[model samples]
Target: MNESELIARYFAPLAGPAGLGLIDDAACLIPPPGCDLVLTADALVAGRHFFAEDPPDAIAAKTLGVNLSDLAAKGAEPLGYLLSLALPPDWTERFLDEFSRGLGEAAAAAGVALLGGDTVATSGPLTLSITALGAVPHGAMIRRSGARAGDLIYVTGTIGDAALGLSLRRREIAGGALPAWAKTLDAAELIDRYLRPRPRLALTPALRACARAAMDVSDGLIGDVRALMRASGVAAQLDLARLPLSAPARAALAADPALLESVVTGGDDYEIVCAVAPERAALFEQLADAAGVAVTRIGAAAAQESVLGPDGAARRFARDRFSHV
Candidate 1:
């Protein structure tokens, strides 16, 4: 039998409140009175999410971060999580130690305890899965379907830094010329961002109030926002000039104008994309200020079924940001 089938037969039935019923990433759990349960899971496989040579600690951290990002999108506070892990038989002890360190650091950052998990040997490749559970107030969970046509769209942190970071790492591995953004950044920073991204749980409480809709930017900014628009039955218009580009991203764009496409369409940015009402702009600004986070108003929603750019014309995205198929 295949691995998936074996898991279904033996592992799935064994899951309960003590174990998730294999319905989703992590377990759909319960919390105290007035609390809402939130669950999310993510998996990373060698040759898929990371290169074999990538640091194990970074890999473990990223696996957790991706799951945490999903919980943040729902405006949930990190409660605890389960780790289902497998490592190749040949993986080094040093690698495992670093990997555990990274994972431990990320969990602590979210204020979550590592409740329980399973570890196994694997001949295929190093793989890690994290199922994060969180709690929010009853009826307070943010979703992707509440945006109105006139709502304004905002993104937290910056838009394109992580994508640009990935490009720099790939160039270095291929022995190609470094991108200008790479030149300005410490090489380690770029590589680490590509691997160990920070989850936006801190922004969730603020967003729970102002945001009409929200989603984490696992896919590219454009594609993720598009999902929000689709869910809310609205169209969006973005002022290209308003995108939150990092200083290094601007430098890269100045050096090689063609790289703008990557900045827009590349995925794996863990920032939050959310919509707020036009009147709530000031309130959002205040909330973000109190939280010491910046929320950029990049665009607004329109009834028309298109996204317009700076010149007030529709811009066609070059590619779909993330797709399982």
Candidate 2:
């Protein structure tokens, strides 16, 4: 059997309800009355999602966080998850302790459980896969296909920080010293965003109320937002002047103006990118403010296929999509 086929036959039985026969891209779970089931999955591989030498606990936390983030986009309260792990022999002790600690901590924070999964030895690089299950009220789940022309586009949290952190990591790999800005910042948080990104679960209710369309920024903002537009059969016009660049990122941009494009196209932000009707824009602002999460209206949906800049100039977005392959 192929890799996924093997998972379906051997692991599906062990996965219980969340497996859904391992048939669809995601399992369809039925929730209680007045509720909807939300399903999302994320997989991480060494040298791709993370480096082999990175801390195991951090990697574990990030794997879970990305999955949780998926549920967050649908306004789902996490229920539980299944894990599939591939480990090499040398990584046993440290990997176990750190990975378990990270996973346990994220599960507790997200109010989820580590229900069941499989562990196997592999000659390939370490890999971790997590499938998170959650529940939202019926008709309350947000979707990427609900946007319309003239809807205002919004995003949560700061962008570009995680990409910056990755650049710093690359510098470290090249035997260069950490830059000054990197030295003063919280390496753990930066690395955590790189490793563990908290899914914005808290923003779901607010999103459902005010968002016409929504998605998490796993791919770069430009690319993911474009996907949302495509899914909804629309286009977009972005105000490049309003992108919420973090202070450090601003500093980095000061050094190199070209970084602006990187900030726009780089991925792993994990923040929510949403669309709101013009009338609901104020409500969204209030909700985001009350929740203490930064939200910015950076663009608007159009009935065309391309995104425009503030000056009415056509700006190119990332052509590449994030892929497991």
lDDT by residue for model 1 (1-325), tens? 4445534543454344544555455554457679989888888888777777777777877888999998988899887788887868786657756776777677777776565566677999888888888888998889999999999999887777777778777776688997554676555555666777777777886788788899999878888888888899987777767888776676777667666667677878888889999888889888887877778988888777566554566778778486644
Quantify all predictions' global Cα lDDT against the true fold. Answer: 0.77, 0.77
| Each candidate's clash count | 2, 1
- Model 1: per-residue Cα lDDT at residue 179: 58
Q: Model 1: which residue pairs collide?
A: 16-19, 57-99
Poorest 10 consecutive residues of model 1 by lDDT?
6-15
TM-score for each model: 0.86, 0.85
lDDT string, candidate 2, 103-128, tens digits? 76777787766656667778899988
- Give stretches of model 1 more than 4 Å off: 1-30, 184-188, 308-313
Please report the TM-score between candidate 1 and the true structure.
Answer: 0.86
